[model samples]
Target: MKVVIVGGGKTMFFLGRNFAAKGYRVVIINRNMEECEDLAKQLKAVVIFGDGSNAGTLEDAGTASADAVLAITPHDQDNLVICQLAVNRFRVPRAIALANDPDNVKVFEKLGIQAFSTTHIVSSLIEQRATFEEITNLMPLGEGKVNITELVIGSGSPVAGKQLKDICLPDNSLIAVIIRNNQSIVPRGPNELHLNDRVVVITLPENHGKVLKMLTGEE
Candidate 1:
């Protein structure tokens, strides 16, 4: 996957290094030449020094064929604009914008862009660190009105034999994907579950218990 990032902050460095290590082509954009050079050198990613909100800059950064685009600039408005161009004009398959304020997510989602609420995730993690073994919390999207939780199939799960269509899954939740041998399978309603398969589910936090039970066959 080729990923284009419209930011040069710590987040970009973290993401760039990870994707590059995994053999994906990553390009990071920023207006500051110094930051660009530093980030590029450190992460071994291509750095394009230009305005991230500019369509021309995105074109030069190859947004037209980008597999995914991230609008993670510090300014929320700039991130929104960049995301709009990537999603609406460029039509990148995955257009995610970093939402600094939880309140602003609705506007971005109205434009049909996926958004990340860093504020809520960080806070929730810090608060839950003492209690949960490992937390996979989904941030609110569309608006700051909903949240999702994901859990994987544990060892010896009883749900493995049943097809999704056969199992009476949670009404408020959906089976998102199944991973086997580290390969992701986006789940379909008729998909069959296999033993030892890892699953990632997207469901409201209120429905987490039901989804977990459906996945692990444990209440």
Candidate 2:
């Protein structure tokens, strides 16, 4: 995957490193030349020193073929514009924006942009900790309509003893992968779920609740 990050803050700095370590093609854009140089040296990622909200800067960063574009600048308006440029002009498959102001989350969502605010995430974590404890990761996909989540299977989970063919998953939900005992299993109709299995799934956001209920036996 090719990822373009529009920011020089700690978020993008660590994100660039992690993505690069995972073998993704990473690019970093920042308005500060010194910061760009430092990031390039530290991450070994392609760095462009310029305003990411500018179409020309994004073009130079190869946004045309980017698999995912992240707009995490400090300014909410700049983040929105960068995301809009990535989705509307460059046709990037995924555009993610960071909403500094909690109130702008709805505005960004209304415009078909996937936005995340730190305040909301931290608060949600506190509220949903028990319910989502098994979730290793959760990311919005397809502009927030769908979510991809990674979950670890426990011994008493509802799907632990069933085969994929026998389990009735929610509509639009698909198990993308199963990692069991250090082995990655491509899920098939006859594949049996086992305890300690790490599963990755994709599903519509509305169906996420049903999926959790089915997997964890919680209402």
Candidate 3:
């Protein structure tokens, strides 16, 4: 897989490093020369110094061949334009944008771009922390319409030792993967949930609480 990351700073550096570690071809585009130099040295990626919102810049970054494009620039307008160009111009399979303002998330989604708002995610996490202790690594997708969450099964969990087919999950919710003792298992009809198993679930935001309650027995 090839990933093109737009913008700079810690997020770009870490994202580039993670993709490179996964053996994906990583390309980074940044407007700042110093940051580009730093990232080129720190990450095993092709670093291009230029404004990512520009078509020529994206072309230079090889966006045409990128499997995915991530636009995480500080400015929301720039991020939106970068994503649009990546999708409509380069025909990239996946394009994600960071919406600096929470209100822009829906707007980005309306324009056919996947977006997430850091402000919204942080606030949601704070609220969830007060009520749900068992849920972790909660990620909002589809502009907060969908969510991906992780929960661990304990001895007292309602779904513990139950086969996936037998668990009554909420509508639009699915246990995508179960992590047991450092191994990942794709959930099947006969796959049984075990104690200490970490399950990754995908569900609509409205069904999140219900799914958690069903799996962890927590209200």
Point to the candidate with the largest TM-score: 3
Considering TM-score, where higher is better, how would the candidates rank from best to worst? 3, 1, 2
Query: Order the candidates by lDDT, highest first — what do you get?
Result: 3, 2, 1
TM-score of each: 0.65, 0.63, 0.73
Residue range 1-219, candidate 2, lDDT tens digits = 999999977878999999999999998999998998888788969999999999999999999999999999999999999999999999999999999998999999999998988887676445444576788888765545677888888766889978999989977899999998888988899999888789998877668778866776655
Candidate 2 TM-score versus the reference: 0.63
Assess each prediction's global lDDT (C-alpha) against the native.
Answer: 0.76, 0.87, 0.90
Q: How well is each residue in 9-66 modelled by candidate 3, as lDDT tens digits?
A: 7877888899999999999999999888888888999999999999999999999999
Model 3 scores what on Cα lDDT? 0.90
> Distance (Å) between predicted and true CA of 103, model 3?
1.3
By summed lDDT, the worst window of 10 consecutive residues in model 2 runs over 121-130
Better of 1 and 3 by TM-score: 3
